[model samples]
Target: MISPVIQEEATGCGIASVANIVGKTYPEMKAIANGLGIYADDTALWSDTQYVRTLLKNEGIATSDNEIPFTTWDNLPDTALLAIKHHQEDGKDFWHWVVFKRIDGNAMVIDSAAYLDSNTRTDFGEMTPKWFIKVSLLHESSFDA
Candidate 1:
């Protein structure tokens, strides 16, 4: 089971989500991001999409980013980083990041902010999948391209 870490602050959700998936502590990932000039006090809480990929790669994780439609959820790997667009009740639209795990036909979302209940099995209620970054922990030789 993956341990969940709540985003320390409102803007750190992206970093926090990635850290939680990669099994790193919030402070540890935050420090690396801070050193790379990616994390700012509060104003710069959101990370540039590409930079998130680079950060994962620098830590030796292989990842591929792609924009996939919500209907194609079945095509997603067992575990992936999902970018979802949600329309808030107040009429504002926001993009949130979460780690997705599919098991036994049930999809689970591991959100750093606990926006989702841990190990939730329900499909996307209001959130729509926009894109995802697939992470591979195995060596390149293990899988064929």
Candidate 2:
């Protein structure tokens, strides 16, 4: 389980929230994600499935066939929930952290980084393979819990 303090910190401030916790800007976070082999582009075409898979693997998390099902949002696992909550609390949007775990039914969570700076809250939603891949590959790791 994620610490309550961390969770509160992440959910409290917007971009500045993560900046305070991780001591880095959104752009810097993108660079770190890119360095970890994760793509960090928001206006790209295809989803970065490989990049997201690589990041999960690097973090000791595993996925089947290097792909996360888009429909796994109905029942997300605890780990994924932790990840999403942490990222969301930290004000992450646009970018995303996708996770595939089987704890609470076979489901995935799409934690968007765009919400960090978005003026509206409708930008974030359920995990889709395409969106998951794109955001996962580009999501900043500096904010990872």
- Which candidate ranks first by TM-score, i.e. highest? 1
Model 2 misplaced stretches (Cα beyond 4 Å): 1-31, 37-39, 42-46, 66-110, 113-145
Model 1 alpha-carbon drift over 4 Å, by segment:
40-47, 86-94, 103-106, 114-123, 141-145
lDDT of 2: 0.32
- Pairs that clash in candidate 1: none
- Per-candidate Cα RMSD to the true structure, in Å, reads 4.2, 11.4
Candidate 1, residue 95: how far the Cα is off, in Å: 1.6
Across 1-145, the per-residue lDDT of candidate 1 in tens digits comes to: 5467677866777778768767788888888887777773543244346656666776777776454545566777777777775434345444667778876777777777645565343456755677677777747533222
Give the C-alpha miss distance for residue 97 in model 1, angstroms.
0.9
TM-score of each: 0.74, 0.34
Task: Give the distance in Å from residue 131's predicted Cα in candidate 2 to where it truly belongs.
Answer: 9.2
Q: Write the per-residue lDDT of candidate 2 for residues 1-145, one digit (tens) a residue.
A: 2111111223222222222223355455445555764443332201223444444455444433423334444433233312233122234333333333333343322223433342212223532333222122224342221
